[model samples]
Target chain A: MVLEVRDINTSYGDVQILRDLSLKVEAGEVLCMLGRNGAGKTTALKAIMGLVRPRSGSISLDGVELTAMPAHKVPKQGIAYVPQGRRLFSELSVAENIEIGLMARGKGRDTRDRVLNLFPVLNERMKQRSGTLSGGEQQMLAMARALCLEPKVLLLDEPTEGLMPSMIAAIRDSVTELRAQGVAIILVEQRVDAVLPVADRVAFIENGRTRDTVDVETLHGDLSLVHKYVGVGH
Target chain B: MDFGPYLFLAVLEGTVTAAVLALTALGLSLVFGVMRIVNVAHGEFFMLGAVLAWWFSSMVSGSPAIGFLVAIVMAPLVVGAIAVLCERTVLKRINYDPEATIVATIGILYIIQQLALTFYGADARPVQAPVNFRVVFPWFGYSGYKLVVIAASAVLLLATWFVLTRTRFGLIMRATQFDSETAQAFAIPVDRVYAVVFAIGAMLAATAAVLIVPIQQAHYLMGGDPLLLSFIVVIIGGLGSIFGTVVAAIIIGISDGVISVFFTPTLAKILATLLVALVLVLRPQGLFGKTPR
Candidate 1:
């Protein structure tokens, strides 16, 4: 296993969020975590990335223990998180925002060219403050910033939330391309159809615990299982 | 009454005051910019700088020029090191909590003040200016050192602006200031950044103090006026704004210079306080400060 999390329990100040959550992913695999709102999907990723402390568990990346590590150090250990809400430094210019990631990891200035290649629009608006960009543009900047870390594991929280349909398709294509490059990804997404093609397996989470893990092909043939877990109207 | 010459003198004096105040208040603004903490002890750092300058200048033999240069270089470094130590030992312990850090800094202020009084004695001491030349104006002669002070402060302020806008260090500081949480996620050690910022802020205040010590007597209690003026400047300039701090310092510094020359110094202070109240009530975000999102 490239990344393994076992028996992880986490809480936010007495409000328990995840209980005995266990998951695994191999290199080049895209693990899509599907759940309704408040189903602990974000919390699971947060715990794995060391943004929030897990009470009891083991999080290992390529056999190295990552539990209890500081969030700042997590990226250096090969994990990059594109947090919810994009969280781009609004006042900073686009180039500066991407530089934050590279500076943190001590990567050379040339690495920016590679990340900017992934999102060409960002390259054009390198001098513009990120807050002025449209939602789609800002999202692209966020992804580019994370990719600057050159992480082995990418944790994306709601990358498609509130995006237009066209933007969602663009993000899906980026995710598929990244997965093919052998970067392990744990994507927290609500849009099932947008994620299905890219996801090798989907973990259905309900009320802070994983209900089951199903292969994408098997679940695609029987849409009712997804409906049962995620609700009707798909 | 021939008031024209007096008016020119007042403006010159105000410009001098404004120059010094800009350096001091810029330090305060930068601290607030990165740490979001109101350093009540910032004035004490200024006091320490002046006090150290006096000590360093007095110790050296021969011309005052060598002593002044030595003090100028030594004071800010010593003060900056002291401040970094304080950040590590005290401020860091409080987790940089807004209210808690304020209280912590206030405590530091008293500790430093009392220590100065204990060791430096109660008498105010003046350091001799390295250059004792005068530039004769139309009505009167002005100390060339005062003019040098004004020019030096301007150059230093410009250098500060360059560092903040054009350098990689400034880039990291701005990124940390914009959103520390996001910066941290990218692997910036925010705690260390905070420590460095705290030191730089203190060092700026120290630089201002070292520059001004030749003109004014260094007293343990002299910090009160600079402290009050700096707060006024930071508040009026909008917290954490470098450009705004400089602009506001000039306005207040010149006004105070002119007002004190014509009227009582008490009234000048009153006007400054009134301006603070007005800015807070009308444009709380300050002239250049962005509205909180």
Candidate 2:
């Protein structure tokens, strides 16, 4: 397992959000997590990123424990997260946004050119403030910013939410490209059908627990398992 | 006597006030900008710097130049260290909560003030100017040291602008300022950055104090005016806006200098307060501050 989350319990204040939640992902595989709003999908991703501290659990990447690490230190451990809503630094320019990832690791500008090649739009809008970008452009910039980290695993939360169909296809294509290069991906997506095509395995999370895990090959023939865990026709 | 020289003098004096005020208030704006906590004790840091400068200069039994130079370097470092300590011990413990940090900083202000009162004594001490020269104008002579203060402040402010806009460090500070949680997700240590910013903010005020100590006597209670003026400037310029703070400082400083010379100092202060009130009523975001999104 490239990433393994074992029996994690997390809470916000007195309210528990995740109870004994566990999941796993392998290198170069896409694990798409599907669930309704308020399901523990985002929470699980946050826990792995160490944004929310899990009270008791063991999160490891390639046998290295990451549960006790700080949120800022997680990316250095080879995991990058593209949070929901494209949280770009609005005041900063697009170049600065991408530069921040490289700056964090104290690396030079080698990866910047490569990432810019991946998203030429970001390069075109390099000097523009990120807030001025369109929603689709911002989403692309967010993914490009995370890719600057050159992580072994990428955690994307609703990468296609509120985007147009063409933008959604753009994101899906980017996911496929990254997957081909052997980066493990934990995609927390709401559009089940859109991600199903690229997903290697689909994990259905309901009420803070994993309901079922079905291979996309198995899911392609019949989505009965997905329907059972997700909804009547999801 | 010709009125032109007097007017020139007033402008010159105001220029000095604005220079120092810019340095002092930049600290306040920076602390407010990144931490979102109004450092109530900010003025105390200014007071502490002047006090330290006085102490360090007095301790050196040498040329006034050497002693003053040592004080200039030592004072800000000491104050910056104290600020870092304060952030780690007090503000960090409170999680930099907007409300809680205010009260915490107020407590810090009192503690620092009282400590100075006890050790530094109640007497206001003056440090001798390191350089003694006058820029002889056609009508009147101006102290060269004052010109040095003004020039130094301009350079420092420019340096600050350069750091904020041009450097990678500035990029990180801005990223952290924009969204600390997201910055952290990108592997930027937000807490460490906050501590450094707090120290730099305090250091700027301390640097201002060290520069001004020769002109004004160092007293435990002298922090009031700088604090008040800085707050006025920050509010008028817009909270956390560095360029705005500098611009506001000049306006307030020159007005304070001119009005105080022509009219009364009290009127100048009253007018500044009125300006702040007007800005607040008309444009609450401040002249240079971005509207909260």
Candidate 3:
């Protein structure tokens, strides 16, 4: 496994978010985490990224313990996260946003050129401020920024939350491309149909606990499987 | 003197004030812009710089120029180190909460001021100008050193601008300022950034103090006016806008100088305060600050 979270418990103050949640992903695999809102889907990803401290749990990447590492150091260890709301630096130019990500890993123009190739639209708007971009374009920039890290594992939190169908397709294609490149992905998404094509396995979470871990083939054979856990159907 | 010479003198004096105010207020703005915390002890940093300049210069027995040079180099470094210590020890402990930081910095202000009073005493002390010469203008004569002050301040301001816009460290700072959490996710050490920015802010204030010490005496109580004026400059310039701060400083400084020469110093202050009130009522975000999205 490239990344593993074993029976981790995470909380914010007195309110617990994740309880005994465990999951694993191998290289070249897309693990889709599905659950109702507040089912600790986001928290699980955060725990792995060290954004939220896990009260008691062991998180490791390639057998390297990451439970005690600081949040900033997580990216340096080859994990990149594309958070919800596409938090781009509003005042900065698109190029500058990409530059910041490159600065983190001590990479330069070569990496920036490569990342921009994945999102060609960003190349044109290099001098434009990110906040002024269209919603879809902003999402592209956020992903592009994360891609600058050249991460081994990518954690995406709701990449298609507010995007249109075309933008959604673009994002799905990018995820598929990343998975094909042998990058491990832990995706927290709500749309089952949108996730089905890209995901290899489904880890259904309910109330902060892993309810079931099933292959996409099993999930595809029975539509009721998603409905039973996520409480929603396409 | 006639109105022409009188106005010329006022403008010269105003330019000097604006130059110094820009450096001091820019420091405060940087701290606020990145950290999102108001440092009430900023003026104390300026006072500390002047006090340290006096101490350093006094230690040297040679030419006043040698002493001034030593103070210029050492004062800001010492002040920056102290600011780093404060950020790590006090501000970091509080997690830089906006309200709490204000109170903490206010406490810091008193502590720094009291310490200055205890060590340096209550009497105001002056440092000699490094180069004693007068510029003989057609209408009147002016201190050549004051002109040097203007040139030096401009150079410093330009250097600061270059650092903010041209360097890799600048990119990290801007990113951290934009969204610290996102910056962290990309492996930017935000805590270290905060400490460095805080130190840079204090160092700027100290540098400004050292420059002005030859003209204005270093006194325990001298921090009050610079503090008030810089606050006005920062507010009117738009809280975190560096360019706006410089522009606003020039406007306020010139007006204060002109009004003081023509009318009274008290009136100049009243006018400046009223202008701030006007700015607050008309445009709360500041002249150059962008409206919240």
DockQ of each: 0.76, 0.87, 0.83
Per-residue lDDT tens digits of candidate 1, residues B1-293?
37999999998989999999999999899989999999999999999999999999999999999999999999999999999999999999999999999889999999999999999989999988989999998789999999999999999999989988898888878888988877778887788989999998899889899889999989998888888999999999987789999999999999999999999789999999999999999999987788989
Compare the candidates by DockQ and give the number of the best one.
2
**Pairs of colliding residues, candidate 1:** none
| Alpha-carbon RMSD, each predicted model | 1.7, 1.4, 1.4
What is the Cα-based lDDT of residue B165 in candidate 1?
81
The collision pairs in model 2 are none
Instruction: Report the poorest 10 consecutive residues by lDDT, candidate 3 chain A.
Output: A225-234
**Candidate 1, DockQ to 2 decimals?**
0.76
lDDT of each: 0.90, 0.91, 0.92
TM-score of each: 0.96, 0.97, 0.97
Better of 1 and 2 by DockQ: 2
Put down candidate 1 lDDT per residue, A1-234, tens digits, no spaces.
Answer: 499988889998989999888889888999999989898998888787677889998999988898988877888987888989999989988988888878767887677888888899887898999999999999999999999888789999999888998888888889989988899999998778867889998998888888898889987668877787788865
Tell me the interface RMSD of every candidate, in Å. Answer: 1.3, 0.9, 0.9
Q: Among all windows of ten consecutive residues in candidate 1 chain A, which has the lowest summed lDDT?
A: A101-110
Q: Which structure is stronger by DockQ: 2 or 3?
A: 2
Model 1 interface CAPRI class: medium
Instruction: Please report how far candidate 3 places residue B22 from its true position, in Å.
Output: 0.6
